[model samples]
Target chain A: MTSRLTVVYGVRASASEIKARAQAIAVEQSVEMPLSAIHDGSILSDIVGQVRAIDDRGNGAFDVTIDLAAATIGSDAGQLINMLFGNTSLHDDVVLSSAILPSEMLSAFGGPSHGLSGLRERVGAKGRAMTCSALKPQGLGAEDLGKLAFELTMGGLDFIKDDHGLADQSYSPFVDRVRVCAAAVRKASERTGHPTRYAPSLSGSYTDMERQLGLAREEGLDVALIAPMLAGPSNFSALRRNHPDFAFLAHPTMTGARVSPVLFAQLFRLFGADASIFPNYGGRFGYSLLTCKAIAAGLLGSFGGLAASVPAPAGGMSLDRTPELLDCYGEDVMLLIGGGLLSAPRERLAAEAGRFVRAVADHCYPRLSTP
Target chain B: MTSRLTVVYGVRASASEIKARAQAIAVEQSVEMPLSAIHDGSILSDIVGQVRAIDDRGNGAFDVTIDLAAATIGSDAGQLINMLFGNTSLHDDVVLSSAILPSEMLSAFGGPSHGLSGLRERVGAKGRAMTCSALKPQGLGAEDLGKLAFELTMGGLDFIKDDHGLADQSYSPFVDRVRVCAAAVRKASERTGHPTRYAPSLSGSYTDMERQLGLAREEGLDVALIAPMLAGPSNFSALRRNHPDFAFLAHPTMTGARVSPVLFAQLFRLFGADASIFPNYGGRFGYSLLTCKAIAAGLLGSFGGLAASVPAPAGGMSLDRTPELLDCYGEDVMLLIGGGLLSAPRERLAAEAGRFVRAVADHCYPRLSTP
Candidate 1:
């Protein structure tokens, strides 16, 4: 197996032009010049990406693996990205199916400064799948949402994150919200005697986010709800790398460009996501069952010895789907249900939370009784 | 006429399921639940996105304008993004064509910290199209690429940037490269009396990049070539907003998911980009003439009264296409040719630089003589 493999996966719907598209991706990504010029076999031949193997998965879909010369990516995440999906992403027909990062690159990125095990221990939801929810609708005041989070965690959630839409606004600034919410969760933990953490949204410009991260940490927040697409993957990865204590959960907002759930999950982990959230198969967003499973598999799979991160499948999940998700994902999953829970009667939130936790608990170990 | 309006752009490619898709976008984006469940029609309707108008753009493509409630986005940049493309981006068929941010959102998320006028003044290219090139083919040592950059700047290119492929690699460590390259350009600028600037690639995790930015500033570098997708758009925007003195040049790497150039340019500018570069028509990359033109138009077009940004067309641009580019883009354009100049014989570099600038000068203002 090649140490550096760049998988050129184009969409099945546009597979008629697969070979040409694959070749285009190779040249466009690397040399940014025509391939024919290298026919004379100069240094450019080795420097440019060359398609080594092609596999047709039938049904109009094909996977072409290109062997990128190790020197193609200049040891930085940004350059690696330029060579991966830079220009190709503009084309609707082509989709980046997958790529194997050089072990050195994987080591440099160091997938999720803290992975699944760390998070499982932090939230104290060991021996079963994790549970999380969002303080949502974007416009809630800090106090209102903090109280709501207090109630939910009191009902028993491992970690409560801010919805991707929740950012620093007049109604609820980031520092205020994070501080208030963290206090609420801490108070709830004291009452319930079950540890629950708050992962506030760190969504802003670098300085803005840096301050937010500092505040969250100062207030003893455990994880950060990072919008990788909105924030920039490198920024999040770097922050995660630097701050090893806090855990991270990725939110899927404006990440449609990474079409495949598997690629989405794999890249997120490689870049530094301890927990990546994806749309559930039968839910509102259009991901299929196979793709969702693929995302879960890739997240927990060994990649050049990189640690396995948690795959959190969200978007339109409810209490009823907990059993199915538990069976599918086993223990390495973080179930996120936003509107599914937020839309329920405010009074019934505690009851709903109890049922959700019980379902996951019962499914994880059917041989044993629920707590 | 509302203070906040979210423009909905959908594809003709998936028109068979138009209404359903439109409704899905409205629900998935805001509520993330079945619309029918909001039977009480209480505050949920006010909180959710409401589709106001839908138009058929000739073929199967249609434009649907949805007005999200004013409080949809918190004041922070991430919330705006979540409201814009978020979950809908997962659906391949749904393309975000164009969006309009309300005045308040626009005010909160200021477009470009510095615009066209600021750049022209800084570069001293007072009245014509600016010329720029990359120190590329990543494997070269810091001194080699730095000398190459010095020669290019001495030859008269306005802005010398690191190729997207050039990162903090062993081959050319970022600090070593930035210091050497900036020194080379500074030395050349002293000799030529030309105000050339070196924009190093700030491509690493947060701390890694923060150090690079500080180093570039200390070394008297004017701008930094930032990969928004790689660093996270929010990260770049934050860096740009905080460090207003250093100009930012946006590079298109790992940004293929943003399908439409028009929408791509609009969003980049909205977030914060002094200059936006895209693959040109007839380039090694597959952007069509129409798409490239649309990208240019969008950057220069007045949206929400934002200052105009420079639209740079790059990728496989040869010396021959100079006049046509001048005609198409007129004055406000940054013609970026990477390998076109770098691939030339070392001895001929000075002449090549002169001719490249001369062509743009002659086209922009025929009476002006090439210096």
Candidate 2:
């Protein structure tokens, strides 16, 4: 029997039109031609996507579940995405809701090399949620950004990452920036007596990223930030396979256009992201509270025995909302506060970061009190 | 003086809200923080994105233009995209309408190594529009797919490309498929006395694609198809630079969700696609006729003295509507008919393909008729 993966798409169509629409999607995704044109019976039966079920969710919305041949994926990460949403993404009415991949496929992908527990161990966080902050203002020099990183690290945050906007610009080349930030974080970690990790954003071509990773490794860095959508999914997966020791913090840049945040969290984890960052509810972006919860669940939930990835709720996150965020996401999360902390005076920056970190540490889970 | 690129965004906001919204976007995309946080005067003046102009297009729509520092992009293709649409793509109301890049940036990108004229030269088609078709229903084995390639080549088509869905599936491994199909196209080309180029769809990691390209080179294939989005923009740009002699036909799969099709055409050309394929107006996808024309123009128009790429209007294109397509796209386009020809019986496939080729060849330009 041919191995298959189930893909679910939320489609907008009336009850009278849904069946044909679902069938058309199956044919369009798989065969790319009419069924009558196919001569081979095996090709028709096995290769073509089979519509497993359709749930009418009322209000012109229907859930379409399709079983696609797993053989079609063939250990290629980009191809897997292409097969799932390549053509269908063109249709505005359809949203790729979820997928159920076979264990073999998950094994091939090797979900996460260093997942939630590994991340927790890296930061030396015993029980409470981890605290993370970003080094921002893209045009800043390497030394200046390093100073900011040092402040954030000194404040006792577990992770201080480069803003996704920071690339190999003349103002702050990747090499110079990585060296300074890593060293600064190390010095601060020694002073604070806490394990603080620096994650420099990885950009450019595969080769450029490889060289950057090498430089980062030289600085004793074990964590890195990457916008998987910008780097390309295949490149991200390949980088993960090549560097098993490094923990990847997946950024949500350029991702909102195609896949749902919930599905993206799962895919990022499968592609070896230790933590997946998303725009939290009541943030700069428009992701709803329900969608944010779903995204967190998708990252932390069990699937094919893969290690759980930590959900990093971010985008306009503030120090004041730490309890609420912790209440929403619980202990297995990374609360990323960027501009919220950086808005403080230069001398008070570390104190602001410390306050943010302490809040996460002190917050008691509402779930514990509910029972 | 810092070099800057002008980016245009279409925002959904009322007249009263447009100015603040535009100002917020400028700061959000650049400093990513409130102006009050930054003490540096230079950063405030130069680094932060400047709101160049905002036009209230009426009905809760406004076209906002902002100038961003070009230094933020470095020399990376992926970084360029990230800078342009990364975080902003998360906003559903904002569409990245277009961008005006500095000449230096365009020069760095080096649009289309083997472009429109080069593609026409390769296929031995002069003056008239080219005819192209895709090998479909992707499950067929290498030998069987090669047979279809032979039939299509025998029909006098200028280009025969593998369907975007066809990857390194076990049924037709990349090496086996490329070898058989290349040989079949060569055989048919010799018999028909017309050079028909075969473009094998490239899918995989950057390394995998590189290996596939090498294999294709060994098979004497001069042109290849790649979905730049799937390969990653940086990888695609690097591939073009690495293989300057090979012509790349870009496939628009998984593109519709983010950037406009018109902008994508220009970006693809700048990233070195010899031909850019998009879904036609009356096709399986929902691109409007006006959008299709704009896409064609974006590909063919002169930009920073870069070579023009051929616009390929595809997706459910048929032989019967060949005249209308030609009239709309003119001679600078590739009329790609895929499943429409494949829907014919097995024996009549070549004859149907021949009819498609003939329809393009025999059509009279409405512009010429007016003269």
Q: What fraction of the reference interface contacts is present in each model, in order?
A: 0.57, 0.75
Q: What global local distance difference test value does model 2 have? A: 0.90
Q: Could you say which candidate leads in DockQ?
A: 2
lDDT values for all models = 0.75, 0.90
Model 1: which residue pairs collide?
A86-B254, A89-B256, A90-B256, A205-B238, A232-B232, A254-B86, A256-B89, B12-B60, B12-B61
Model 2 misplacement above 4 A: A366-371, B368-371
Question: What's each prediction's TM-score?
Answer: 0.90, 0.97
- lDDT of each residue in A10-92, candidate 1, tens digit only: 55535567777677667766666544433334335566677776678788777777767666664455566566767667665
Q: What is the lDDT of residue B312 in candidate 1?
A: 89
| Displacement of the residue B18 alpha carbon in candidate 2, Å | 3.1
lDDT: worst 10-residue window of model 2 chain B: B362-371
CAPRI rating of model 2: medium
Q: Candidate 1: how close is chain B to the reference, as a TM-score? A: 0.91
lDDT of 2 by residue, A1-371 (tens): 78998999999999999999999889888888888888899988889999999999999999999999888787888889888988888887898888889889998898889999999999889889999999988889999999999999889999999999998989899999999999999999999999999999998878878988999999999999998888889999999999988999999887755467788889999999999999988987889999999999999998888889999998887899998888888999999999999999999999999998889888888764554
